[model samples]
Target: MTNAPFVVMKAVAKRWNGQLGVEDISLDIDEGSFVALLGPSGCGKSTSLRLLAGLEIPDEGQILIDGRDVTTSAASDRNLSMVFQSYALFPHLSVAENVIFGLKVRRVPRAERAKKMKRALQITGLEGLEHRKPGELSGGQRQRVALARAIVAGQRLCLMDEPLSNLDAKLRNSVRKDIKKLQRDLGITVIYVTHDQTEAMSMADKVVLMKDGRIQQVGTPDDLYNRPANTFVAEFVGAPPMALIQSSVLGGFDASLTLGLRAEHVSIVSKGEGQLSCTVSEAEFLGSETLIGLSHEGTVGLSVLQPGLALLDEGTTVDIAFDAANLHKFNQEGDRMSEV
Candidate 1:
């Protein structure tokens, strides 16, 4: 892998009907790295992907691939492959045909196309189903066909836009692992777009989180989870999300500040032994851990992820405490305050 970034977006901005699709966006993607563009709908993740693919030209920025400006390049000229949410496979074509479609269009020799098709099929685990049509295959298989097509293109960069959104939960998990493994095996640079944080955290080396047309944070999954740059990142990055409580509830912090704590970080302690007290509002049994939802003096709702089945009934009072070192403090503007 190269030491320099394989893809670069400098001051990229896109506008649609006087509204910003993505504003002042700049990102560097290292060669052979997996980067996820993550956020909810309309947050510009898809827009950014399109810009990189040359489907959408930026209003004010330069896009360079391998140190050459491709801002005005055509999608085909960019030499990148894209896999979309819909699978985008031709219903009339067989899996093998679909996988080799790009090579055929480029007038590659039949022998070369056949070799690449077989290699892509084997890598994507679609080896035996080459003769099947998209309509005859399961959702996961069809997705693999799409992936095989991208792989057969032999591009150094691959772009994915919510490619697993159509799969069932079980299939999504299976295919997610396959995609990550395939990227690693191929050593291709990948820019994946997804609203699912779990996918971003589990697959990508770096996560670029976006909100309302701008980047909210860019870092490793651990960095976003353990040291969020602000309240939005703190709330959005975690599962069960982070519980934020007003500083007044704890007494010693600034009144205008909020304290953030992960559900896993807060433990239930004996009454009077903890820093704060709460009444159990709900208890959810999730096999490996029990999620105890609590209401603290009508001010904030907090969740405690206690290991195993430690069922605390509703209305039962419990004391909860977290390590002071693990607390995340955010000021009135929702920006994180530096550690004291």
Candidate 2:
């Protein structure tokens, strides 16, 4: 028989008073894999992480970690470490002190704590800055201190709640790579919560996208990008998102259906030479390319990517073309249709 999942949340749910927090959540995670709980604010991603970390007991269903049912276990009883978005470091404590505080509280011997602290500091690249207090360090350095603390605990599973959110864009990118590398080197399972799709798409082996206290989809980055489960996912997963057009606007398809396609699949052709004619709504220039937003009578998120800098004027008429095979069809309820 095959081995069981390293972690499982079986129909787990939570609520406050009469309102829903998270409902009917079920998932399986493999060992040493990075899984990201991703969604917008109030989408229950953090609540789900709290439930898995034993910070919030589930109102329904069971949670299993390493084959043990910990649905009702206390947070202390679960062998997992947590890093929060706020860093949660004591300003008065030096980096070394903060890193080993958990071990000290657990009554680990002084010598052993020192050994663990040393390795944690080395791994997180904070060896020279160990004597500095949290207030004395940069935002990124303080966050690393929190990571060092988690490392020193020697837990096989770690939960991080938007640990990079406080950092600036550049620092977020830097620490994002650091956290992914740290998780890989330690061979630990990580359950991270984030509102940013970029972090989830870049760092996670699997992504569980939630909305309104429920899961929308769970799959690899590629699966969520190329084969979204529904319209919400199709519109939310990409940078520019997939452009959707009513099937009535196109021929050879059911009028009740919606058609989805990406900007990369759309090309600009000479006037009157393409499938659909649209008006330019806006043009945005990135470093390497420009995106031209298009407006048609029955389409949303319609756009085409132009190489270099091609700034089409607003209200300029353009013709865009795409292969029929690239179209993704959806039903009235927004669910994807199977390939025909």
Candidate 3:
């Protein structure tokens, strides 16, 4: 391979009858790195993945794979593999047949195909189930079969379109680790599409958070969590999300500014002895800690974490304090400000 990046999308844009699919999308994927395209539904993550996969041609810009321009090439010529959200296996085919179908199509020798199938099955823990059809396998097993198929060809680049969406929570967790381990063990590059922040944060080397057909942020999980580029990113990247308070709610700040806060940075103080007074809206016990949601006149998603079973009553007034240094300041347009 050349010294260039493994995959590159330079200002790629896709539209359907002048309706935007994804616009001005540009990204660089390093060899063997896991990059996640993460966003809400209809936010262009899948569209971007499709553009990269050559399933949809871009109206503008170019796509390069390992220094070769493949913008107008057929999907079959991309030299890549894909794992879909729907485990696209033939119902009549046994596990071994399904995994080696591509090899068969390429007219690989019988011995070589069998060796590849055996290795893929071993990597995916499907050795004993080789004779079973898709109808007889569990959802997780079917997904593993799809993964095995994707990797059986030894493609260096793999695109996954929310491959774990069909599995239940526990199965999703198990298969998530399995996929990451598979990618790492084989030294393959992966571009994964997902709307789940947990999956992106846990599995990806980099996250591309998108919204409304645009990339909101591109950074590491910690960078997005700690130094979000703007309010949209600040709110979208976390579970409970960052709380936004009107700057006027606090002293010495412009009314047009918004201040962002995290639950970990907020502390409950004695009544009337803190920065702001809030009403307890609800308390959710999460076994080890209680997530205490609070409401103030000018705050959105205000909450604090209280240690272990500290259930507070609704409408109870509590004082909350936060350090100035821990606050994130934003302009009226919601872009992050360096400091107050």
Candidate 4:
């Protein structure tokens, strides 16, 4: 509960077989904040999580927890809990037994273990499932057990690595809320690693985006979406992902470079000054809204967000418009330029 960062990685680097895994990553995670490490597969998000957990040692730099150096400390000495993608529960052990396995290994008395187990089960909404083994529980239930175990570990930090990946879409959405609520209620500092941008944006207090084993951007969800630091971040955080088009293809000047805009930021407008004209390539009505795709003469496509049933037939010529205030510009190297 101090102003000092609860977890710190100073100039961290990791290499494997002459390949760079992660390079010069320095981060500060505050106490009680939920931070997500987001990246595509093999982008070093999971590796970074393991380094912070003390399960893998960094080749360079230091790892500090609560102002104490734990760079080379044993994973047990770090006093942290980890919830994996797999529940990793024992097949024969009951939920209650699995939840308190760590405490049992540490020689905690049965009376105290029972108290801790009860509290953990209550927090995770699995109070009556204690008697059931992993084989007897549903996917969601098993995941909850994993979360409950982390809670009962009574650690200062919790590291969750794609804990929701195995669940179905519906189950993932529900359990995501449950986990976020649980974390907020407990006021614990958590580091979450996930390849799902939706999960990252919806749950994390701060989102740390990585690419090619390097840090890209770190900000709140809204900040990451509304003001992406670079083209990689702008393209990575959105649902169908942000659209990046060459400005020249859209009839803008040669100085225009690359234009970045979210799907919803685009629209169909009257053919006039400042409008980019194209032909309707395709359209998909998704309940309350419609997605209209436009393709220019040279095959440059732009996505337009239109309201319900405002459908346009394919091959219809249309003028594409976007809010000038919302457009982001990027150079050839993908560095962010001022909004044009």
Cα TM-score of candidate 4: 0.94
Off by over 4 Å in 3: 1-3
For candidate 4, what is the lDDT?
0.88
State which candidate has the highest TM-score.
2
Q: List per-prediction Cα lDDT, in the order shown.
A: 0.92, 0.94, 0.94, 0.88
Off by over 4 Å in 2: none
Q: Considering summed lDDT, which 10 consecutive residues are worst modelled in model 2?
A: 127-136
Candidate 1 lDDT, tens digit per residue, 175-278? 99999999999999999999999999999999999999999989999999999989899888887888888888888877999888888888888779999888
lDDT-based ranking: 2, 3, 1, 4
True lDDT of residue 318, candidate 3: 95
Q: Provide TM-scores for the models.
A: 0.97, 0.99, 0.98, 0.94
Q: Give the worst 10-residue stretch by lDDT in candidate 1.
A: 293-302
lDDT at 151, model 2: 95
Judged by TM-score relative to the true structure, which candidate is superior, 2 or 4? 2
Better of 3 and 4 by lDDT: 3
In terms of lDDT, the best-performing candidate is: 2
Clashing pairs in 2: none
Candidate 1, position 104, lDDT:
92
